[model samples]
Target: MGWLQSLFSPLKKLWFRLHSAPKKRRGIYILYEDVKSCPYEDVHVLWSILVESHTLRTKV
Candidate 1:
């Protein structure tokens, strides 16, 4: 069992890396800067507005 687990451990890690969400820290600094500059009082509102604008731009 130990040998089987060891043989598959690298494959499991590869699968996880491919399927997982990206690391948040990668873009957290950018998000912090955007939040600092955003005028909306609620961060959720800002996020929705950004999402809407992005969707609109992509659709056009």
Candidate 2:
């Protein structure tokens, strides 16, 4: 019984970690609002670069 208790303790902790929501907020809503308020040309360029790189990687 003692060994079983010890064995399950780590498993229980792992389960809690796996199921728990992230602790910190990413502030995506704030970023989206800011982008909507003042759209930037550089933002579009950066987004296009990111998309192009992603597509290039996937093609390989």
Candidate 3:
């Protein structure tokens, strides 16, 4: 049992390192199928919210 545990210790550390790493953070992406669906008024409201929230990146 001791020998088995010793042999697998390095593998356990590697597994933990691979699994516990932080993933890349992504920002919001809004897509509208119809171009005319989003009106000027609605875009103004969305812009205000994004500004207040400090949105990093937005793809529309």
Candidate 4:
């Protein structure tokens, strides 16, 4: 009975650590190629619009 408790104590600690650890957060990143009509400026504008739209949608 004592040996069983000792083994389970470590297993219980391992399970607790796995559930309580913080997870890394990540964001979406987009890469675009520069063209005649769609240069870096246009690309960034589109990106901002998309991000803002997503933010608004999520807030509602």
TM-score of every model versus the real structure: 0.36, 0.49, 0.35, 0.41
**What would the TM-score be for candidate 1 when compared with the true structure?**
0.36
Task: List, residue by residue over 1-60, the lDDT tens digit for candidate 3.
Answer: 999999999999999988996865444334322323666777767766765575444333
TM-score sort, best first: 2, 4, 1, 3
Q: Candidate 1: lDDT over CA atoms?
A: 0.78
Which should have the higher lDDT, number 2 or number 3? 2
Clashes of 3: 0
lDDT tens digits, residues 3-24, model 2?
Answer: 9999999999999998998775
Clashes of each: 0, 0, 0, 0
**Cα deviation of 32, candidate 4, in Å:** 11
* Candidate with maximal lDDT: 1
Q: Would you list the C-alpha lDDT of every candidate in the order shown?
A: 0.78, 0.72, 0.65, 0.70
Question: What is the model-wide C-alpha lDDT for candidate 3?
Answer: 0.65
Model 3 CA deviation exceeding 4 Å by range: 23-60
RMSD to the hidden true structure, all candidates: 7.2, 4.5, 8.1, 7.2
The prediction achieving the highest TM-score against the true structure is: 2
Q: Report how far residue 14 has shifted in candidate 1, in Å.
A: 1.9
Candidate 1 positional error at 37, Å: 3.8
Find the 10 residues in a row with the least total lDDT in model 3: 27-36
Against the correct fold, how does model 2 do in TM-score? Answer: 0.49
